[model samples]
Target: MDEQIITGATAAEITASVRTLHERGALRPGDALPPVRELAALLGVNRNTAVAAYRLLAQAGVVVARGRAGTVIAGHEAVAQEGYAPDSVLRDIGTGNPDPRLIPDPTTALARATGRPVLYGEPVIDPALEDRALAWVRDDLPGRDLRITVTSGAVDAVERLLAQALLRDDAVALEDPCFLASIHTVRLGGYRAVPVPVDSEGMTVDGLRAALDDGVRAIICTPRAQNPTGATLSPRRAADLRALLAEHPYVLVIEDDHFSMLSQRPYETLIGPEHRRFALVRSVSKFLGPDMCLAIAATDPETAERLALRLSPGTTWVSHLLQRLVLAQLTDGTVLHAIAAAGRHYAERNAAFAAHLTERGLPTEAEDGLNLWVALPVAAKTVAERLVLRGWLARTGDEFVLSERSAPSHHLRLTVHDLTDEETARLIDDLAESTR
Candidate 1:
């Protein structure tokens, strides 16, 4: 609070002084830095020098400019999925992955890979793969001049989309109880994640609008089979979101349909034709397997062009071999049927598990995806500890939150569809007893 504390003649010195303040615990997260003009006068520097110092701090993620609210210390730390504890003798059900047995074998498709080795300066996307992927997304994509760009996975596509357009400290609206990867990606990029609460009908309109008022320049949403919470955007909800987003057409909307082939619900898009900037991404991990590491990003040609800079040939394009394999599996009728069957399997099993819990008077619901989002009667971590004693591993929902500082909620995202009859009964019994 002392004027003599901030001693600096140039931008570098001013930035260093702020960092020292934070390091010494004098300035904590959410604490506002001095105004540009005030700091300039105090440090005997011009206003431009103070502004440049703030910009440096913003880009480095030391502070965030909150429009008229001035700048505040950057406060987000990305949350990582607490993978199952190693060496624990428990039936692990915490991993939010697909049942491996359902994933189609790529061996038959691999032999179909017959082509010349792609060289530098050649086109980045495999032609057949691009064509097929485009057809897959065309039905739901809004723009007439939509373009497709393939990336290693959905996370890669989202990362590239944001990095190409946004600056550090720019606000991004994210679903609360969001996907782990999306949370990690946005926060690690130094963007503030404005939490939008998601209900059974998907992201709440009020939540989205509140975030927009906070000056969020970007939005990341899951239209169907949302992770951590098995919420899907209904037709009415999608229409409301599209209408609200139309007012801010320039806000970049990136929809991650990561459960495309395995989602029980039909593809309902949020991007309106009139909306200028938006993207739709579908990754093959759920259906084919996570190891495939491939996804298709459909966006306006301008965004596609900008995203291409990082995917240019000879630097970071997806491999032609992987493209061929994905294309082969997609076009084959047999594989298509297999994919459908897998979708049904996940839906039926998840529904059954949710039904069992509900029957036991422990509320649970799973509209789609590979997991069930249950409303626990007790703190999920405490229930998780009880499960551990019963030789079961559970994933608590608080780990998926945007702010870990908030009060822990009574929810657990469980991936127990793989359990057998007795295992399910025993786990349900244990869960019921633990709640009592």
Candidate 2:
């Protein structure tokens, strides 16, 4: 065992020792440091002095007390030093991520817009943006009687809608292997999560019916470009889901159209006219830019009223500047042209990856959005681990699971945009070898 000989006669000495350990790469994110008692005994210092030092680190976001898990290094600082800049990695085949290179350059436009100071107590949603947004939303939701409200993002809209509609411990149905953000939000809000099964055609109607039978009060569905799987609800599937939902008219149904404009697949709205309470959330992050942090929540009057209550004047309204910036890009012909180019690029690149996988005798399906969901012959986790060993990071299907079930899936979500022909071929070869 290494000797921890910090002769700290004072609190300052203890603090300095802790800082030195962090600076010298002794501690890292998710690494639990020695307990205060152990440190105190090892360093020949008073327990209070060690405690104070730990507290100081915690206050400075250097460490976090995870209750039973003990104190661990807090954020990205340690990871950054370890060369774990998540965004800089090659071929990040993870979540429903959009290519940052495609987002229109906002520097010049934002600088010009910022010249005028935004006044306090002004309307949260820019009128010009609202008009355009309404038109955009109305396009797919044609002739549907709905109202629109803007939120920071789709997740925010989900949280607020749930808060307004459901109480703690009330059950909400979600897609099994659901989006991580939805899982986190539902669990954090003290709600019971009911899992609805998903297959290639999207959320299964039978599974949703079972969740409803379990007394769920709400359901969050993804109709197109379902994250992690890149699955869309086929027309037949959508009709079946609508039929299943018609029975539970009072239950709040939230369809997160997260892939909205970026989706290369034809738009299918799951909110059937007969369903009395529902909301359709479409986010601009995947198409415009994640930093834009804008989403339009269109809902029936009752849910809209409750959502509006949460967004009242000062509470949860998105910034007008962001709204204006998004509006500018949405209306600009040049920006629209860029978005069209991005769509084509994504479809072509993903198709190339699918072909590469097929050539290597690996099963793969190329779909809309910026990523590909390839089905491996072995377990997805095993494949992901093998990729990690080869210096490539990927997300496994298990991370998306929301229910208790056996039978492992062989699917791996991969972002293929940045990969060249050589890189794609290499990835396919490695994947085939890993499976074998």
lDDT of 1 at 192: 75
Candidate 2 lDDT over residue span 1-436, tens digit each: 1336344667777667666777777765677777888888888788998888877776455676655777777654210011123564544556456677887897755753443545656666677776887787787777778788899999899998899988765789998867778887876675668888888899888898899899999999888888767788899998988888888889998989888776788877667777888888988887787778989888888898888777766656787778777877887788888888888888888888898788888867886667777888889889988887766777777767776658776777777776777877777777888888
Clashes of each: 0, 2
Using lDDT as the measure, which candidate wins? 1
TM-score list, all predictions = 0.90, 0.77
Q: What is the C-alpha lDDT of each candidate?
A: 0.87, 0.77
Q: Model 1 residue 99 lDDT?
A: 82
lDDT string for model 1 (1-436, tens) is 5546777899999899889988898888888777888988877889999999999998888898876888988776436653455787788887888888888898899999767889999999988888898888887763467899999999999999999989887889999888999888987898878999999999999999999999999999999999889899999999999899989999999999999987889888779888888889999988998899999999988899899998979789999999999999999999999999988988888888888889999877768888888898788889988888888888888878774445677888888877898998898899898777
Q: RMSD to native for every prediction?
A: 3.4, 9.9
Best by TM-score: 1
RMSD of 1: 3.4
Off by more than 4 A, model 1: 1-6, 10-12, 16-52, 63-78, 82-85, 403-406
- What is the lDDT, from 0 to 100, of the residue 257 in candidate 2? 89
Clashing pairs in 1: none
In model 2, the runs with Cα more than 4 Å from the true position are 1-91, 111-121
